[model samples]
Target: MLDHLIGRPSDNWKRTQIILTLLASTYLLFNGRTYKLPRSLVVTNRILKQYAPWRIALGTWLLLYLTKHTDILLGLDAPDPLRRMYKRSYFRGTWVLTALDAGFFTAMSIKPAWLRHLLSVVFSFYYLVFADAAEDKTRRVRASITVEHMRTSWEKAASNPILSFFSSLMRPSMTLKKVIKVKRPESSERAQLPPVQVHLYYAGNLDDLPDQTSLLLHFPGGGFVSMPPPCHEDAIARWAVQTGNLICSVNYGKSPEYPYPWAVEECYDLYCKIVESNGKVLGYRGDKPLKIALVGDSAGGNLVTAVTLKILTHNQNLLTSSVSSSFVMTSSDTSASIHESQAIPLPAGLIAIYPCLNFDLSCWMSPSQISLMRAESTTSLNGKSISHLLESKDHMRHQSPLSVEPDLERKSLWRRAFGLEANHAKRGTSLEERIKFMPPSMTDLKGANTSMLPSAGFVPRLAMTSRMSFFNDRIIPPGLMRAMAILYLGPHSYPDFDTDYLLSPIVAPSSLLAQFPKLYMMCGEKDPFVDDTVIFAGRIRKAKRENSRKSHHPEGDSESVTVRIMEGMSHAFLQMIPFLPDGDRATKAIGRWAQQILSSDDDTKTSMTKSKSLSNVAAIVTNEKDMIYRRRMGLVDGLYAGINEDSS
Candidate 1:
């Protein structure tokens, strides 16, 4: 009886899902958040509302029953292993998850404050449990250390309600691997300052390594607000194990509390100290020249790029100030000379994993902002502003052909039996507008005029349905994106959105970017920021070419900038290593690359005649031997004209 009810959709469950969706959507609409969502999400909401109640109920039944045979509705074109794992572990009871998602929204609409709070917690816990299960596949040893003199005034207790609220609710599952407290010598200049905590993860203890070891400075992404889970630690530990290197995971302060210059300054200072100490502070012997690399995902990726640029600019400032050309190495003693501390050098390489580079609020504005801008625009439709009239169903009904369908009689009379024509006259005008506004589908374009179509015309239905590539990500929703932008860039430290290269590294000068060491960037094609990564790689390529020409070496510079776009993956996939085969393959490949960079002789002193571009880097990095999953791979050449035909 249970199998019959759950194995296939019942008439009762179908009605329940539709009713729940409608109720939740109504709740969201009234909450003032629907207007702030991405247009794609808003459009989906509008389309759902246009459907007749009974039709929605019947269609739900059909879709649920049909989709049970395959994972198409999941919209994840990942490997079979990933799909099976996601199905069995994360979303085993699909109905339960769906109900929980709906209940989360509906709970907020409840009248009683106490009951509302209680239901919200009950719904959200189950939701996070199911969602987090996909990434909770590994365990590793971990350690935390507090960096002295790094805290800012913004970090005072109760200074930020946003940070405080999230901290209370989201508890990190931390397992202490080992704790070692090494006090700074009283003679050190920074001994009196407050400490900033940093997390350390590795496959083995410090004793397992030799005197010399490479170190990775890692920044995990949490939208610059929340704390990273243990899965991220597991990935770092795996990398440490694979490369036989130590990994230092930074625990920077979250935004709205620390905001803008706080985290950036903190990361930059810690990085410099690590370099100045020459690996001594991180429990290293500092006998041999230590290789350091930067790795960050999402917001952390932004920090990596920003800190690297800071180093380049700092060195430039020092050069202009008439500092010596040669770098002065600081002694391994607890106290180093001021000159030695200032002479910090660049790392061996830096890796960015689906980083958020562009911070222009206008580019990623919410639907409400778009509506307000449109309402204020000069353009008008029938004497009313375009956006103003667009919001009204009566105005749309008069303009849309779907609302005035002349051939409704031609549709089969049997449509009524299937709920297709049951509420034809009663349907909202939003359905008509959605149909009118949506890009021409494949069916609409078949055998039509080809010459009149725009250069960038119809998008494949799959691209739209597969929410993986757009603002539909559950991990980084549009609402959260809005909050992060307002919090991170709202501060005075990042005043100029157009020219803040430190905040948005993609716009940095070519001369400064040319000074960068080897760069390795890997992002999932399904990520919303995939195109931005492509564009940044192209800019680096351009910088290399320009720098080479300026130096009178017509052949390009050999600064290895590798970019690998994994197919059928999403942002921050590295955190799911071991459980995800693709994630594991990508992580191991990165480990090998890091190992090669650290173990090699000083390649900076040697000059190679061969020029290396993104294509060449891809060939070297994602070779047949590496066995990476890349269905589409190419270089992005042009910058101003946007992505070229061969890009990504």
Candidate 2:
């Protein structure tokens, strides 16, 4: 069999290589100690274990990309000095996965069909069960936060010597000089959005810029548990410079402590306050009022849409009395002026990237979902003993950067930055719930009479890897994400919006959708929440058509709602800005799209921008096949073409 695959009789070098490969692979697969393995052995095993080029490529990409993605997620979760140490350990530990993938694909590459399936089903069991003895050597801690833990976390963040050491290791060794331009912040000021602190940023030379400016209200996502705008300083800085848009990012009070509705209420109130300010913002003097736009990723996406819905409905009672009683809207102009007023305004456009639009996906049980459920049992994001810390690192990053996250910088940085103690509001207590959902498989993928035995060239095997599924992006399984979404409100926070369509914005009534501003939405096709984004995109159009006849005022052809599903990408793919190639392109696309969305049509500006943005998207999507492996019945591009006059 080995000779058949190798194409000729084995030479001395080939014989020695195969013997060494088998010995090394057998040792790693059956070993009690994993860390002691050599890097050469691991790499060799990964490359030669599977004869099928496609399987090898899929496995290699999966190991590399998932780790990178998770690093971004964990980096945002909480700050810590130990990340580099654990990451180094994790980079070393992916050998087990490499070995496993190589072995599985090696079997599938064999000739006999029944033998292949039998071996696969048997190997699948071993992969999920017996093979998980190697827990992450990168175990920081596995505990919930209390007062003491919080105090210790603050110390860790504040201890300069420790932070410097970690920061040194964590700093980018190479720069994507082309992607990020270092522009000194000309000035920054705080806008009182009540409980929400909006950090307004501008270019260093504000006076030399054009008169009319666009204000971008930005929100960063950390599962709604943690992560503030300042944490995303690089992105905000680049965006402010790239688009020449004055940006204000909110540091909203979070859940667990602040609870549900607080963030959105603050956001809505802040926008109203900006409207009420007249010309009070620091760096001004444009003849016209700033063109207001709303943008957010993840949880921020949810808030962006929620606030927009509240404005559209004009529902004074949408929020609970306890929350909204003190929350007053002080718009000097009335309803008509809301549409026409230059001084006071409704947002010109709304942009959401992978917002958690649907909270009901936890119950979905497709074959892919089942596979994910089984997969999770083997590599739970939680638990010290999880062999796949690198696998879970992506999710762990989102949970917290440090073991305990310090929210207040006064107790943290000193009086100048923030005089107050931090509010360590968390979204949920139970992120470890997925470990229990062991999905039944193979039977679910039945019905096709043919066996999917491999052949010569690389096979199109997108769905089988940890990074992908038949119908979804296999990052965090839908079932697991749903659990996190349920827990996002935390125990102290009341999920009053549980049944309310307003909370899960996609489910909102079509009448409300029709009332929306020119909306631009996006999501990674592999994102578990992708369905939510796609459904919401379609709903906006359908709602507009439904309400147009009844709409006292219908949206004009120019008022656009657009969505882009970046191919070969998953949830939070933009988070990879300046690092991963896809992330870099996605970030650039977002900047160009934002500019085009808010650009004025006076003379050739709008048409020229539209053409430029469309061209930019074409340039970004270099390989269409890699971009979209699987879409929902091909509606990904279909929906974009149907709604707006332009989809750039």
Best by lDDT: 1
lDDT of 2 by residue, 1-648 (tens): 466577775566578778989999897768746356588867886768667878878888999978866855444433432223222322232323322332344354555765654564455345444432211210111122232222222222122243335433533321111111111112212232234456666654555444645667787665565666645554666677677776778877765556666777767766655544422342445344456678888888998898888765553232222123223323321121211111123476778887887555432323433232233223222212111221222232223322212112212334226556454452333233334553576344334321112222311212222222212222343333443455465564544444666567866876677767777777653455655665566567666766775656665522456666554355655544434556556666677767875685532221112233233223333233223323432675677677764644
Clashes of each: 1, 19
- lDDT string, candidate 1, 1-648, tens digits: 333568884667777777888899898767767778899989987999988889988998998877774554444333222321122322333323333333334354576766755675575456555553322210000011011101111121122243335533432222224323333333345455444457766565456554645777787776676544232554665676776666778777776677787677677777766665556777777565667778888888888999989878976665544223222222322232123223347777788888888776333333332232232222211113222212221222333232211122322335544567545564444433456454556467644422211123412111111122144443344444565677676457636766888877867887787877777777764465654565566567667777888788875443467777665455656644424556677778778777767766765321111121122222333242122222111122234236554364
Residue 128 lDDT (model 2): 41
Q: lDDT of candidate 2 vs native?
A: 0.49
Per-model TM-score versus the true fold: 0.52, 0.47
Candidate 2: where is the Cα deviation over 4 Å? 1-195, 208-212, 285-287, 315-344, 365-487, 492-499, 549-559, 601-648
Residue 199 miss distance in model 2 (angstroms): 2.0
What's the lDDT for candidate 1? 0.54
